[model samples]
Structures are given as structure tokens and as C-alpha cells.
Target: MDLSFLSEQVLWGISVGQLIVAAVLPLLGFLAQSVVRRLLRRVMSRLRKEGDLSVVDDVNRLLTRPLSFLINVALWNGVIGLLDLPEEPLSIHSWATTLGMVALILVIAYCAFHVVDVFAGIATRAAEKTETKLDDQLVAPVTNTVKLLVALIMVAAILGQFGYSATGLIASLSIGGLAVAFAAKDTLANIFGSIVIFSERPFQIGDIVEISGVEGAVEEVGIRSTRIRQFDQTVSILPNQTFTNVEVRNLSKRESRRVRFEVTLTHEATVAQLEDFLDSIRHSLAQRTDLHPDQSMVRLTKLDTNGLGVLVQAFTISTDFAEFMVTQEEILLRVRRLAEEQELPIMPAKEVRLSGEVGEPRSS
Candidate 1:
């Protein structure tokens, strides 16, 4: 087989043409991007001059991502077209090409939408009067959910472009949903629970709370679980559903804690002395304006064989554990000093017995 059919002049011309096109395409690509960038700047400057910074900022950010993507895409297409593709015996399907183009367009639209969403999130947070990390918490889920929906729609559209049926896929998913539901029951419960928790706000991150005998400060409230940093320096992970179903005690909710305790006094105390002691305690407590005025209550409740049980109630202004402990100690110390000055002794239990109860007399 003598292959002298291909002439050198034709091959040389094709190579020269490819080289020239490659060198010129880059210059053209740069000019196009430069023109687009100038147009965007002019538009943004006009918006800013009109005192609509919000719109200007949005447009500025929106143009940047897509413009960069567009410029890169142009460069790529220019390079690809410049190459002298081989003339070989091959077949190409028009339908497949059309489907590919549609998918490409869909992907580009999705990316543009994603850029807009990011800018919107930033603008929303900046415009708010008050700041909260909850905004940060919500943005991820909202953005992801939107992206997922958009992607699903784009996929369906692309599939339809290829003559695939959306209804058939939906039916297949429905058929498989039962088993999937069974496998993901906990996840579903947690998702639903997160909704409830966010709406109700039983507890938030950084709040000291107690639930199911576990006491700790909430570290994070996630979509599926809540993490708490325990007092013992370990972390506890509880399912979000548990908080929805079980009782949660939020210590941060209460500004103060009411403390209850009982102290026994000697049964031998005279009524006058007891009255004096009670009056002293009341007076001492009344002097403490830091404590809730309505919270001070002391009473003689019961008389026991050992002593008189005196019930005492007081309030601490702060729910902080350390503060509560300090206030409690001070109150007890004051009570002790006052009792000592009044000579009221702490009651002590006693036992007495009689000699010669029943005995036969012996002859001496």
C-alpha cells in the first residue's frame, strides 16, 4: 500500500493555519473580557451614583463570578476550535450533541444562581440591625437545600432532553422510598426535631441545661444532634428528637434560684428566745436587698423527739452555680453567728433508761 496520496503542501498549510489561529484567539478572548468588564464597571458606577449601594454591590459581586467563568469558557472554546481536528471515519449523533449542550447550559445557570445566592446571604447579614450566629447556622442549610432542588430540576431537564422520563424516575424513587425511610428513620426524626427545636427554642448553644440526668452547657445545636460540654470535661451527644420528647431544664432561663433547707433547733428553747431568733433572721435577711425581697421566709414547722425542725427559704439573685454557692454559705454563716449570740444550741438526740424495772429481791 503506497500512501503518497496525502500531499505535503496540504499538511503544511493546515499546521500553519492552526498555529496562526491559536496565536490570534487569545488576543480576541482578552478583548472580549475587557469590553465586558468595562461595561459592568459603568453600570455599577451609575447605580452607586444614584445612591443605591445595595444594588450596585449586588451587581458587582454577581458580575465577578460569572464574568470570570465566561472569560475562561471563551478561552477554552477558542483554543478547541483553533485545533485542526483529524478527518477520520467517525459518526456523531445530533440528539446526543443537543442533550450535551442543554446539560452544559443548565450547569452554567446553576453556577450563576449559586453566585447570586452567596451575595444575597452576605447582603442580608450586613443589612440586619442585630447579629446572631443563628444566621450562620441557617444559611448553610437554606443554601444547600436550594442548590439541591435546583440540581434535581436541572438533572430532570437534562434527562428529558435525552428522551428520559421524569415520571418514571419519580415512580422508581417512590417504590424505593419505604426501605429508605426505614433505614433513615433516625435521620428523619432528627430533621423534624430540629425544626421543632428551632421554632420553640427550648435551649440554644451556650445555655447551661439539664436533660435526662445529663447536665452541661450546650456546645452546638446541629441538624441531627445536640452536643453538650459536660462539667466533667467530656462531650455528650444527644439526638435532637430527645430534646423534643423529653424535659429540658434551662438554667439560663431563670434569673434567680430559690433555695430551701431545714435546720434543727433545741426543743428546750423558750418561746421568747425562738421569737428573738426568728426576728433576727428576718432582720438580717431584710438587710440583704441584693436578694429578692419576697423570697425570704422562715418558719417553725414541726417538733420532733430530737429537735424542732425549722424550715428556711431564701433566694439568690443569680442562677450561676458559683454565685449560688457563695450566697448559700454566707446565709448559713450569718445564721450560725446569730444563733451563737442568742445561745441557741443545735438539738442533739438523747436516750435515758430507768434502773431496777423488774427484779426478784435476793436474801442478803
Candidate 2:
């Protein structure tokens, strides 16, 4: 180990000691990066065991790599400056500085992305507390939009490092205004569609709705589309713009579901017998608490070529489909027993395509 060699010039007044320092900084930087990353990972692991938090995963994705890159770039920049590298024709110093700036911009954007996730988590918690599901639907779109803006700003900053005027280009619309407009037309329409959905509120998240012949429970309402989970467990994604000028039937909004059925009698039963049977059926439905009080009815609605038709129609107070099915089944069983008691020859009407006990119950 000669002490004189340590002070000997290596290049452009930079010593062997400085070159050794240059070589050593990167090793230290690398070690520091791994240690910090491991520490953060350990912290995240502890958090995961305590409670479920969305931001835990967000921090790992949005902070780890960019932060490590930032540390590496900073160390690299320091080494380039320490050597006093030449700036003529091509310069490592200039390259390092530009790279560092780009790295800084990226790290900042990633931090902003983490902020967006944090905001989304806060918004989601708040939305869950409210009664209206409309707020719940709004969280994703707004968060995604903000994240997208952050990404665009990050790109602009990186571009600026290379001497591109992002603002001037945007102001001039030099990329071709018509082309940009055409490109964004659908996106603009979708944004407006989301606005209309929020304002008009044809259906909320979790509502069973039928739109454009597609029926399902709305799983999510996003800026561009709506995700619907159908009865068969298949998901349907419809463009938000589709809601603008279409009919949407909110099945959840109904006060009651209609219960209707038609039964035919062989001409064996006379008018008086049929009348008494119908009255018994009406009276039976009226006594039940599940069926609507005023809506219960049984009448001879048709005098057809085949036979006399006894039509039964009522409404159930509950909106639950499973409960509605139960109510319909009870009514059908009751109607059958009543018809048999009266000694009336009854037959299920072939014309009743809805397939109910008395008739298929149609929702109203």
C-alpha cells in the first residue's frame, strides 16, 4: 500500500483516491438501496398482519422501485461530478445530470401515484359510511383520472429535461387539433356520460337494472363503462355513453312486484261456482301480510273459445326476488286448494307463457 499512489493523478486532476471513492460510492449506494427496500418490505409485512389496508400494497408498488432508482441516480451523479468529467462534444456529467432529473421526476410522480391511492382509500372509507351508493361509484373514476394526470405531468417533466416545450406544444395544439379531438372524442363522451349518470342517477351501484336488453346487478360504475354482474355470474361491460340516450329499468326502485296468473276452467263449472271460487282466492290473498292489501284481485277476465278464464293478479310488498318467489309459490298452492274445494275443473292456461302457479308473476 503506497501512500504516494493515492494522490497520483488518474485523469484531469482526479486522483487515485477519488477514483477509489468513485468506485466505492456505487457499492454503498447499492447496499443502501437494498437495506431501505428490505426495511420497507418488513414494515409492510407488519402492517399486513395488523389489519387489511389498501395503501399497504400501494406503497410497495408506487414507491419502492422509483425510490431505489432515485438513490442510485443521486450516487451516480455525485461520482460523475467528483471526477470533474469533461463537457466537450459529449459529457458524462451532463448525461448524469439529465438522468438524475428524469429519475427525480419519476420518483415524484410515483409519490403522487401513492398519494392518489391514499386519497382513493380515504374516499372509499367515506363512501362506505354513506347511505347512497352513488359516492362509492365516483371514487374509482376520480382517482384514476388524477393518476392519469400525474403520469402525463411526469412525462412532460422528463421531456422538458431533453429540451421539449410540453406546454407550448399543448397551447399551440401543434400535434394537430383535429387529430387530437378525434382521438379523444369517445373519451370526452364517456366523461360526460359519467357526469350524466352521477346527476340523473338512473341506477346506483348494486342495483339490479336492465338496460339495452342486458339485465344484471351493477357491480361498478366507472368513467368509461359500467360493470354488471348477471345472474349467471357473467360480467357485462357496457360503455357509459350507452346510458345517455337509452332506457334503463331500475328493478330496485319498484314499490312492489306484480303477481299475475291465469287459470282456465272446463265448462263444467257454472258462473256462480266460478264466482265463488274466485272470491275465495281473492279473500285468501287479501288476508296474507306479504301480498299488497289493495292490489289483490281474482276475476273472470276472459270468456274464451277454450273455456272460462280466471285471472289472478296481485302485488308483493317486498322487493327481494327470493322472497317474491316464495310469495308466488304460496299463492299458487292456495289457488289450487281453493279451486279443488269448490269442485271446479281447472286447468293451467297454455296461454300463460310466464309459467307461474296461477300465472307468471310479472314485476311492475
Candidate 3:
């Protein structure tokens, strides 16, 4: 074989060899990272089990992220060196290309891992601050905002690494702002709405609230809207911005659920019977343990030509809506039974006098 005559074929062979070297090392690096991650996780788990750490320790654990990142970067660098390209222009180009690919992978992975760490730290700090309650609505948005910012930075860094100026990318986005704004107007509105809801905290998830005249239990509070489960078992989606401008009634925040209702007395009932009726209502409410028991009051709030209006007021012992309704029903039923026992008319009264008397004063 004339070896000098096979120049082109020799170059092709070298290229194929370089490709094989580059491919195998990165695969090996990935496998090594997986093994290393598993080992680290196991060790951490063991340490967590044996160590005297308070159950509330999430901040210090995020400290592991930088070490994990360095390890991953080292493995990637090892793969690049294994390619073993020459110092010549062609070989340098190949090495630069290979390094670019490795760097891109490392950058994406590092950004993702760092975001997780940041989010974990955020959650830990939030947990430590509030003991009796948590502002959980904040975590998702705060973490997501950090992740999105980090991702954008990573992308810009990657582009800059490829010799594309990141400043130019931002400038380009600025120039395209009008179009972007027009296209994403609704999305921006939703984002603002999310911020308002998170900051104002008109109502939280699992709260029974009434907004825009619709009453329901809040099922979820999302970035763009909120989900409500109505009493009829239907789910309603309300734009988050709607809450920003509308008056939101959070029923859960009421200190005492007030029960206000009017009971009617018959026209034929005497004044003595009305007093007896009022007393019976007060006594009936006193028997329910679910009610405040101490604050029960009944009075003749109104009297019309048609009937006597007895206004009953009581405070519930619980904020729970279902229990409040049950207590209310029990009180109403008891009042009804007492009224019947005293022969107090339960229906609204209407006296029939001649219409001729409407415009004329009749002598008593």
C-alpha cells in the first residue's frame, strides 16, 4: 500500500477517530454524574436520618448545589480533554465545537439545578418566618420568577459564549417590545393580577369567598386566574385582575358568623303572645352548643299593618360554614315548634278593610 497516496482517506480516518473519542467520553461523563448523584443522595439521606437536624432545616441543605455544580462541570471538562484534538486550525475548530456543546449542556444543567436551590432556599425562609400560618401563595410566584430570570440569563450567557452579544439580544427585544406587548397584553394583565392577589391577599386558597356576586370556595389561586368551587358543585374560573378591581368578600375572616333572620307573627296574635314568641326564640338558641350561647337575642324589630317582625340574632361557635348552617336550621326549627305550641300565628297577617277607607280618615 502506498501510504502517501491515501492522504484524504487518512484525514477522514482521523476525523472519524476524533468523533468516536468525543462521543464516548461525554457518554461516560453522563453515566458518572448519574452514579455520583445517586451516591450523594444516599449519603445525604443517611446523614439526615442520623444527624440532629431540626425538622425545619431547608436552608442549609441548599448549600449542596454549588458542590454538585462543580462536580458536573469537572466531568464535562474531562470529556472535552479526552477528545485529544491537535493544535492546528482544523483540530482547534473541532475542539472548540466540542467544548461549545459541552459548555451548553453544563450551562443548562447548572441553571436548572441553581434554580432548584434558589427555590428551596425561598421556601425554607418562608417556612421559618410564619409559624401559625404560611403565605404559601407567595412561594410559587417567587420561585417561578427566579427560575424564569435565571433561565433567561442562562440563555443570554449561552448566546454570548457563541460570540453573539447578549446586549444585542436585549436591544432586539426592546425594539420588538411594541409587538410583544400587543401580543402578550392579556398575559401581562394576568401576571399583574397574580402579583396583586399575592400581595393583597384578599383571599387564600381554601377560603370561602364571594367575588363578582358569585359565592364559592376557592380551589386554586393561579398566576392568571382563580378557581372557585360553587355550592352547586360547579367550578368557576375568574380572571385574577377581576379581583384587583372588584370588592372581594372573604367570609372566612368574619370573627363571628352572624345569623340574622325575621320570623312573622299572625295578625290575630295578641301583644302577650308576641312577647312569649320572642322569649321562646331566645331560649331555643340558648340550647345549641354550636351557637355562642351567651349572645342570643330576639326582639320585635318591626311591626307592620300585615304582621309583627321578630328579628333573631345569634353568633355561631364555629367559623365552619356547614356547622353554622346546621346550627341555624336547628334554631329556626325550634322557634317554629315553640311558636306553634303558643298558638302564635306563623303566617303574615292581612286585615281586609274597605278600599273606601284608604283615602278617608275613619273615626275610631
C-alpha lDDT of residue 98 in model 1: 51
- Candidate 2, residue 73: the lDDT equals 73
Give the alpha carbon lDDT tens digit for every residue of 64-114 in model 3. Answer: 444556555665565556555456756674656556565756656565766
lDDT of 1 by residue, 1-364 (tens): 7534333234424465566666787788788788888999899989989997867767876776577666656565555545534444331234435544574656477575757586656746663543334444555665666677777877887788778899898787985878888989999899888788777777766788999988999887778888889999899998988877788999878879877787789877889988899889889888986689877998988787868877779888888888888888888898889889999997665667545455855455
Error of 3 at 202 (Å): 3.2
lDDT computed for candidate 1: 0.75
Q: Candidate 3: which stretches are off by over 4 Å? A: 1-49, 52-98, 101-105, 108-134, 173-175, 348-364
What lDDT is reached at residue 208 by model 3? 87
Residue pairs clashing, model 3? none
Question: Arrange candidates by TM-score, highest first: which order?
Answer: 1, 2, 3
The most accurate candidate by TM-score is 1
Q: On lDDT, who's better, 1 or 3?
A: 1
Badly placed stretches (over 4 Å) of model 2 are 1-85, 132-137, 167-177, 266-268, 303-307, 347-364
Clashes of 1: 0
TM-score, model 1 to reference: 0.72
Write out the backbone clash pairs for model 2.
261-358, 261-359
> Which scores better on lDDT, 1 or 2?
2
